[model samples]
Target: MIIDRIDRALDMTSAIVAGIDGGQYADASLCAGWTVRDELNHLVGGMRIFTARLTGTDPGGEHHDDWLGDEPANAFHLAAEADRAAWRRPDALEGVIELGFGAVPAPAAAAIHHTEVLVHGIDLALVTGQEKLVDDQECERLLGEMRAMDFSMFRNPGMFGPETAVADDAPGHRRLLAFLGRAV
Candidate 1:
């Protein structure tokens, strides 16, 4: 059910992307430093990285920051555009393999991909003045992961003092983003 909501959200996001008007792609976004196109691309590119890793073809994880070589925003925009197109490919749905991450199977990569698509789609919509809605289930799953993950992973260090306490019962999606310092 959660995955279904995510998949639906991704599909809606793709539709929104397809309708973007001329040069609207270059407009600035709420991401502070990134544009809508850049955010979409970044969102999709991050998924591809997970795809590669789950396939065991990502290389012993030795490359700590594979995306380090490219502009983070551009990396996402360019990669996401390609990936968005790739999702249209017939083989896209056939992907499934396990590189292992605790109980998370390779298909969990699909979940992660869905999460990025939906959550970042909201970001894109917010910046582009588009309509974006997240299903309750999808929000729950994302909020769960956001809580489980340190979230500081996306932020600069020392931003949250060790004494800070995140209330578990806080609204899930907001909790996730806020913990990452993006909810504000």
Candidate 2:
């Protein structure tokens, strides 16, 4: 079920990336101080890193490397394909992954990966006027899961900020973004 959610998130992000125009890449994203291109590169690099960790292969670059190159959309697609394949492996969720923070169980790592991809995708979509592309049900599900966990550890600079208030009647994606400290 988690992997299925991840696949859906990847597909949604891929669509958002494909819709991005060259001129819009430099626009500011919901992530403070990060442009659209910066966010996209980070997303793609994260995918590669997760895939490498799952398959025991070289990630081929650092987290902040310029992975997008001349074709940002194409780069994202390639990374997504590899990431999906690695996550689909029969034994992928059987062990722990050595993340920069520490060794996290595979299921936890997958949840974090899903959050990264989905949140960043929403960030991009919001900035690019494509908010309609976000999956509200997935956002609601993730928001509930986050609320059930102790997510405060991730609330720091460059990660999630303190939770912001949003109207209860707001859309699911907007509520999730607000909970993650984005001013939605």
Best candidate (score: lDDT): 2
What 10-residue stretch in candidate 2 is worst by lDDT? 151-160
Models 1 onward score TM values of 0.51, 0.96
List the global CA lDDT of all models.
0.53, 0.92
Q: Could you tell me which residue pairs clash in candidate 1?
A: 41-76, 41-77, 42-76, 42-77
- lDDT tens digits by residue: candidate 2, 1-184: 8899999999998888889999999999888888999999999999999999999999999998999999999999999999999999999888899888889999989989999999999999989989999998999999999999888788854478888999999999999999999998
Worst-scoring 10-residue span by lDDT in model 1:
59-68
Per residue, candidate 1 scores C-alpha lDDT tens digits across 141-170 of: 666766677655434454332223357675
- Residue 72 of model 1 has an lDDT of 42
